[model samples]
Target: MSLPLMPKATAVWLVENTSLTFEQIADFCGMHALEIQAIADGEVAIGITGLNPIAKSQLTPEEIQRCEADPDTRLKLRPAESHLTRARKGARYTPVSKRNDRPDGIAWLLKNHPEISDAQICKLMGTTRPTIQAIRDKSHWNSANIKPRNPVTLGLCSEADLEKALAVSQPRSSSIFLVRASEASALSQPAAPADTGHYGRTEPQDAHSEAESLFRRPASPAPAESGTETDPDDSADF
Candidate 1:
């Protein structure tokens, strides 16, 4: 039998764009709703293995074949496993109570690095605005009364601070990854001009003109009669 054309990206896109519930999507994609939720939340990484036997009815030949063909591609297509399930199956996860619940380090970052705003701190810490505020407010770690501490001392500023420091200290250089010497070497060589003919002009093209040209074409002439004569009734005066 011919295979169906369903893909994992399409499935995820449908889930995001459509109002379908996890259960409905799970039923449609031959996966458990819980598993689908976990995948959506990025708690677990999906694998190439097929869904439970109960969900096999939803599997199409194309999806199965694609899953089997590539392990990485198949992972994208499958639902994520639950954290509880993974842990039960011997996967390690820090317990909620033990999960470094304190935000003192974040507060230290904000207080010491006054130049950086709460929003900047939030982006650097990979957290929400409210969470950052909570840290600043000392709601989580009671850091308001805490002693003077730099982000480096709290482990929140090393990576981000290094980059910021480099940007401020160094001249306008191209290579952000390598040392100054390497960047200077790279800057010495000039880059070749890009070929613009194949891609049209570098400047923005007029959308209206492009669309009009695409849809509009010259009309074709009508074909002349060969041996057959035109009917008198059909003939028109020139």
Candidate 2:
């Protein structure tokens, strides 16, 4: 579930402004009931300002009233606004500690993924074209000390954002290389030979019968012809 922007502050507001029990507020804020009780007892968040979830469109007044009426029920956060209709915003903010590491991330992107465009780098790293160019040319103020590092490892950009940027910034040459590699792989394999019905010890039935008949012995001559054509060589004794 999407949470209110400042949960502790919202808990403080609920505790100070409403009579809802600690459990309800804790459930809504994703905090422990004992922690809410500590806030109620003035043991935690001593001087923090409370943020109104209702004012921020993160909660509804009617939902708050229903939860106030029933102590056992949990509070639900309002549904998020659709990004499809939401207007695009400016560049994201980088923390003070991580600002110096931008050059390292930029240099890494330039070296490793030169196909990525400068605009994509800017959007992903919260940097500008000049900074990217300076880093690429080794002309930045800290170029000497800057070492290429992953923006994700440095906490400068998310993996999702990096993937999205890569999708948008992929060079045409890389695609051409992929296509050529696939074609080469396809051409290297030999084609399979066609299947023939003839296999081991197999032939037409008519041809097999004709071949067997050719090997048959000839029939002996009749005994009557022996008496008319007897010769001295044919008799057993002369």
Candidate 3:
């Protein structure tokens, strides 16, 4: 049976730009929705089948170039070689498949916001400070090759939500009021005792003594009465 003609690009574009549901598109292409989804996710081969055929030649050279230039537009694309292929090349290599290529938590934090500190990243990811430092060092974790899982893709947060989180995670400068040991000791010491009259052996002065010292007056002499008595006697004789 001859296969029907359908371009992979057309299918991909339909998935992205059309209002039609995946099921509808799958039905139109005479394929299962899961198949269409796989094609969209770059997890399956998209080509002509017994009932469905891909019309790749239908796209203009410019359209093909555009698709190649934009990675987002490319569907059903895979890495050039698998780990097995690399091993066959006779080069000693670690199998990329065995390891998580995803960036360490700190790398993700730094990539998203260049200004973020290691401590801040550690706090945000709930990871250790040393782990964050190791990620930043690029010794064990190569930031350039590591691909971070998008928070949006993971459904952990939206892009806007991440922005807010970054804002909240920023280190705030705070003024700490610290008291020196000497200053604290000075403040804690008891006040000196009030001055007393005894020399070399000071005693606590009473309130009365304090008041007298604060406010005291000198004594005045009594006035004479002889001159006044003589004037009264002269008046009685007259």
The prediction achieving the highest TM-score against the true structure is 2
What is the per-residue lDDT of model 1 for residues 115-167, given as tens digits with 9 covering 90 to 100?
A: 55554555444456777776655574454555434333333433334356445
**RMSD (CA, Å), each prediction:** 30.5, 15.3, 18.5
lDDT of each: 0.48, 0.81, 0.48
Among all windows of ten consecutive residues in candidate 2, which has the lowest summed lDDT?
A: 79-88
Tell me, by lDDT, which candidate is best.
Answer: 2
lDDT score for residue 76 of model 3 = 32
**Local lDDT at 42 for model 2:** 97
TM-score of 1: 0.24
TM-score-based ranking = 2, 3, 1
TM-score quality measure for candidate 3:
0.28
Question: TM-scores, in order shown?
Answer: 0.24, 0.37, 0.28
Which pairs clash in the backbone of model 2?
A: none
- Span of ten consecutive residues with least summed lDDT in model 3: 82-91
